[model samples]
Target: MVLGGSIAGLFAARVLADAYDEVQIVDRDTLIDVAGPRRSCPQGKHINGLLARGQQVMEEFYPGITNEIFADGVPTGDLCGNVRWYFNGVRIQQQEAGLTCVSASRPMLEKHIRRRTAALPNVVFVEQHDILGLATTPDKSKVTGARVQARGQKREKVIDADLVIDATGRGSRTPIWLQELGYGLVEEESKKVGLGYVTQHYRLKSDPYHGDLSINPVANATLPRGAIFTKTDGGRVELTAYGILGDHPPTDQQGFYDFVKTLAAPEIHEALMHAEPLDEPVAFRFPTTLRRHYEKLDRFPDGLLVVGDAVTCFNPVYAQGMTVSALSALTIRNHLHSGAAPQPMQYFQDLSKNVIDPPWEMTNTVDLSFPGVEGERPLQMRFAQKFLKLVQYAATKDKAIAAQYMRAAGLIDGPEKMQRPGFMLKVLLKGIFGPAKKTPAPPLVPIAGGHVETWSEYRNAA
Candidate 1:
């Protein structure tokens, strides 16, 4: 049984369909018959991408899934040739080989996955119901089922299952549920980002960028500000601008335009200002990047597990969430293939090594560079951050550096690849002779609630 019907939940159900006698997905939101909006996912209204890694995993899970979505009008792009990346305002030159991804709105992608999951013979979707508690064995050592309340009804139901997987996302009730079941409070690690986003959808003109989605530019810094404009499935484009460290966008239309004008790249602003507005600007705020240390818990009740955003939520600037979910589904598949009961603790330990380690390191490495980002910096973190700066500086001139960086960004390789002999030599030579100065201090210091204020706080404050 899967606890949520988002991508992670659906993906998990697909895999379990192959392994288990029966698989059921439970959710509080009514599963709408069409590919339109639902209440559970807010980000579904915005643009989202299937990274190279995610594309591969999705294909593996549901064969020809990518082609099917693209066939429905979603365009695929070569990650290096089609997409553009900006680091600190400088465009990283594109490269060739092994970098390819798919672009589509979150709704279309979920529609595709939902259709596939729904078609499986042994899979069942139980919607419009709330899971009240877990039904355990007499000794409370094993979760045999879940107790649920039917939506808009006084009736209660019990769902019997051999295994239960939680993919309820960042605001999961699993921790509270577990504590009620005699477990201690779950260990958690979090880093405050104070990022705010305003996204608007537009209809592109039949011009240079109308049907082609070859370039998507992003800028993420201490004062992380960037814009994303990409082609969606139905001849539409999504233009979104976001700022980290307290630079929230105002709701007024003119203020929105001015906000985009401040981006490192003009692609997003240009598209938004020039294109036809399809909808009003929708705004959302994300407080912190959080990770629950489920693997460290000494005891996890048998027959229960967790995955997806509920496990480790990263800063969205990296666009790592869906890829991480796909990878986590793959991890769950491998564990079942090994003939083991779905072990929650063991699965998370493996996840930290597989799905979580690379992205966590990647995001946290960048976050630590921010002046007042509140998090403990390990000794190796300083070296890694400086070394990455060297590579970023070199990437401005060398396509090889850009390719390697993209490989890491795509989760195709670990950041430690930068420490390898050949790459390390180039970074060293560049650091020694290149005109780039030491990376600057973070532009602001953290104030209350781990929010940041301008650097002048040091000199002007009482």
Candidate 2:
């Protein structure tokens, strides 16, 4: 049984269906053929894109799914060459890295994955049900199943299962449930980032990206504000402007435009000037990046495991959540290939050491670089931040360095790849001697004559 029918649970169910006779996905939301964001996923309305590695993993799981999404009008492109990436207001040199980037909204991507998982013969979705808690054995050493209650019903019932996986996301009740079962509390590590972002869709009078998929002005310590202006499945564009350390984007129309004006990418602000608003700006706040040290636990019940944001919730700006969840699913597949239930300790150990550690360290290092973000930055972290800045500077001059940097950022390669002697020497030489040329700002095009209206005005007219 998989608890929570989001992307993580859906992936788990898909993998479990191959090993188990029947895999049941339990969620409070109606899981079948629904479009748009779910009430459970607060960040669903924001901009989301699959990194190169994530696209590869998803394609591996569901063959031809990428083409399917593209057929539905979602754009695809080379990770580095086709997307505009800005670091500290300087554009990274574009190069063909042969990496795939799927620019799809969170809802559209999830909808496609959910549809594929639902079509599996052995997978069933138990929708509109609240997950009461875990049902354990007499000694509470083994999980027998899950207790769930249908929506609006007082009666609760237990669904028996040989194995139970928790993909309940960051709000997982696993810790409290484990404490009740006599097991000690799971260790947790959190870094307070105080991130807030506001998103709004736009129907542009003209294409700003030309043929590119998106424009990203990544946040940095010097200017802790950024935005992702990207093309989505529809004939509209999505802009998610963000700030760190309590600096939040506004939901009001003029306030949102001012926020965009503050972004390093002036093109985004220029594009929005002529765009017709499709919806009122919506905001989401993420207080901290959280991780449950499940691997550190000495004792865990058999037949119980956790995946996705239940284990780690990354800073969304990095766009690592969905990718990490997909990787977790792959780990579960490896563990289940033995035809026996996975050992909790061994699985978590592998997950932490292999899957979670890299991105966790990367994001943490970047988050701590911001002086406003409250976290202890030791000497190593300070040195890493300096080196990363050097690399970013070099990336602006050298396409090879830019491609390699994007490879690491996309999770296609480990951070260690950046530290190799050859790479470090190249970065140093380029930084010291490379010609510094200013990248020309994108041309500000005039808005063609049209009566563009805000969403509120459009609604009022109707």
In the range 110-213, model 1's lDDT, one tens digit per residue, is: 88899999999899889999878788998778888888888899988889999998889998888898898888788998889887888886664322232234
lDDT of 1: 0.76
Instruction: Pull out the clashing pairs in model 2.
Output: none
TM-score of 2: 0.95
Model 2, runs deviating above 4 Å: 433-437, 444-462
Leading candidate by TM-score? 2
TM-score of each prediction: 0.90, 0.95
Q: Residue 313: error of model 2 in Å? A: 0.6
